[model samples]
Target: MALSWALASGAQSVTSGHRTLFVTLSIVVTLVTLGITLWSRHSTHTTGQFYTGGREFFAMQNGLALSGDFMSAASVLGITGSMSLYGFDGFLYAIGFLVGWVVFLLLIAEPMRNTGRFTLADTLSLRLRERPIRTAAAVANLTTVIFYLLAQMVGAGALVAVLLGSSGGGTKDVVILILGALMIVYVVLGGMKGITWVAITKTVLLLVVAAIATVLLLDQFGWNLSHLLGTAASKSPQGKAFLSPGLEYGKTVASRVDFVSQAMALGFGLAGLPHCLMRVYTVPTARTARKSVGWAIGMMGGFYLMTLVLGFGAAALVGPATIKASDPTGNTALILLAQAVGGRPGSLGSTVMLGIFACVAFISILAVVASLTLAASSSLAHDLYAAVIRKGKATELEELWAARYASIGIGAVAVLLSLLAQKMNVAFLVSLAIAMAGSSLVPTMLFALFWRRFTTKGAVWATYGGLIVSVTLVLFSPVVSGSPDAMFPGVDFQWFPLGNPGIVSIPLGFLFGWIGTLLSDERPDPAKFAEQEVRALTGAGAY
Candidate 1:
């Protein structure tokens, strides 16, 4: 909600020791990142290496990297806070996020690996008119990437401020700048290889930290899962309602609709996240790609399960009123929980645990931003500059250089936007990002892979129509101007009711694809479609 937040109730103050430990741990993390980047930078000597990690990563390696990309600090804070605040309904995000991988594994992973080289646009260009398809996909890619980048950057700033126990205004801005600069350095120097290693490392650290916290929390409740829930129900303001569905989304018809919209966004949107999907290309084979997704699913699934303990644990330990007072979004809940479970609030044990979470959170933000920046720059360089601007005449070296330069440009834009929108609803922006990803990419990519009748016009319409409608709807929706938490609280132009546009825009993506294909005079080529089908299914003639 607001950028200005006090420490959580239990954490009335951060000890000097705690702040020093956090700074030290953070410095160690930064150095580790640079070390990885330096090594990876040396490894990246070709266009293939820069864009796809030279396709040498094993299944588990790429999978953990993929997990690193998907699990942002914003997501961890938001989901855990939601779990603490809304109980069961908040767990829906974890469910939706994990289930999206099923769609990816079944429908996208193998095909994407077989068809794409560096970006999704490459897969579409095989059958569609290369220019329009690539341009539309690139635009959608950049738009989605920017939103995700902003969400992560803003969350990073806020979380950093919270960890340091500083007032947000200037402190948050400074963190955003520093994070942006580090992200630029990571992508410009290390590229995909560097980003992959960073993500792998981040994921491991997150799992370890989360596991330790869960064990400590369970021990606090005598290792009884049922006891924890009972205690959480006892402590929450809503009492027993905290364990039920209606507490959050079932309260009203509009709220119910928002629930469905949210489910759609998390499920399909995560599946279609451009950056996440492109990681499949980094693995060596389609089988490895599929296995990597399986690995990602398992890893994230375990992590989501852990959120249950942390979330309800916090609710049981740190009261909702205290959490809301500190930060309305429930972010302070996690830090407060860290403090509470580690030991007495403000004590050495509690603050040390809090400091550790801060370190992992900082790395989580860095890992995600680097990956998104890589995807954004790769789309701009490979799809737009080399393919569109130079008409495929650009050499490998020129394209590689273009990607590095594009990373800086993209990082600059993200930093500037994050600073401008720091006070806006970061959660709302994140939802819109996921919704737009689903609407813009899901239908287009699915049709290109499965539907024999799919054409360039269909791809173009699906990408542009879904992208425009979802964004336009959100612009007029409560997120932008009507409700108390709206981006512009002083305005009241909201006409749309749903907070997430996924339910409406997602189906429209498919409908627009069908409509555009029928409207186009250009006939689908059977030979090319045959080629694509064989290549997609059997991995024949794949790059």
Candidate 2:
């Protein structure tokens, strides 16, 4: 088994002292997070508090939680690893992610908060008769949530395997199960209030760790980023290591295209993410939502800028061979680089830095999983069970209980899927999730917000069409085909050079939405449509 060998290799790379420290930190964070969840359950009893924190969260508080919701292990570790391995090309991802918030602030933030209550489905179906539109929106939301959750859970397993110094499938599976149980508790007990608090704390911690690492790394080279870039450029062939264009610095043309497309997908997809949009509802007014987006942009921009230093520092000191050796598990690049910079794993400085980095990673996972659980639970309880099955007759207590049960069920399914995909590279999984969000959810959400001509039929057709196209392309993409035989045997077709399908699929989503609207027989009442637009733009009816 290649998976067993890979896990064994990871085990051999970690020192006993490092392993002990990592496990202890993980257990402690897990316990504290759980304790908070249980405490919050007693305090939050209504569906309003469970889903949107009773609309009482401050703009700054929700902004910090938005930061946590957006920055996952993929951004924290994967982006740092990419920058370290690919030079300036890696920072491109950081730029794309931060710039995406500008789009959110200008186009989607206030409108989304004013239009929806618990989920995006609630907004899209507000003007329609409800059943048909709600069902379609729920389907789209659930598809994106499941795909994203699977990627996060798989990343968690890989991170645990690396930290614990174990290469066993059994070990990785155990980690997934443990994480799933913890995440279920986080959602069912803590609800929105607890999730928001944890996310805010985690975001602050992540920003501090990244800032400290960047400063220390730059200090190591005498605070000269240009000098470091010049040296790396000279060593790399074609002298394009620091340049923004072309496929120099050891990356192929295909890899370059992959990076660009992946960035676009991640950037645009942020606006469409159900969990991120849901956070806006926690704030009281449309003006507060606008302010929260502004805060998120500033925080995200600062974090991305720091990532450049860490990536370049790793490239300058850690070497390419080391990154290649750990390509299967990119999340470890930052950890390994930390060890390299601080002397050895057992050194006093190295241990402290490693512990800090590991805690940041753990919190990143916890925050992301909490968001995913909320998104999935909202779809199941609010959209499907309450709106469809019960015809909107369920009591508030019944709705709350249904959401809690849904959280557990969703968490369980995610754990199983993650264990099955444990041996695959997490970067590919993350890109796939981004592609799905961009293709299926982004176009529909944007059209709904900005276009008055968008019809119920248009929304339904576009959402389903985008979902089908993205999921199919991802399943047959090069990344999935090249996965270990254990995961997919004898499948050898490659339809796209870049594993992420957003480059083509995103355009197709827009096309479908446009065409579906054009062909629809029904039109919304002009008076009601105008009123909805005014409220969305001005936040007049959000309360």
Which candidate number has the best lDDT?
1
- Where in model 1 is the C-alpha error above 4 Å? 1-12
Candidate 2: which stretches are off by over 4 Å?
A: 1-10, 231-244, 248-260, 328-330, 482-490
Clashes of each: 0, 3
Candidate that scores best on TM-score: 1
Backbone clash total for model 2 is 3
Angstrom error of the Cα, residue 518, model 2: value is 2.1
lDDT of 2: 0.76
TM-score of predicted structure 2: 0.93
- Residue-by-residue lDDT tens digits, candidate 1, 108-213: 9999989888899989998899999999999999999998888888878776776676764799899999999999999989999999999999999999999999
Across residues 230-319, which tens digit of lDDT does each residue of candidate 2 receive?
655554443653545443223677766666667778788777777888888888988898899888888988888887777767766765
> What overall lDDT goes with each candidate model?
0.88, 0.76
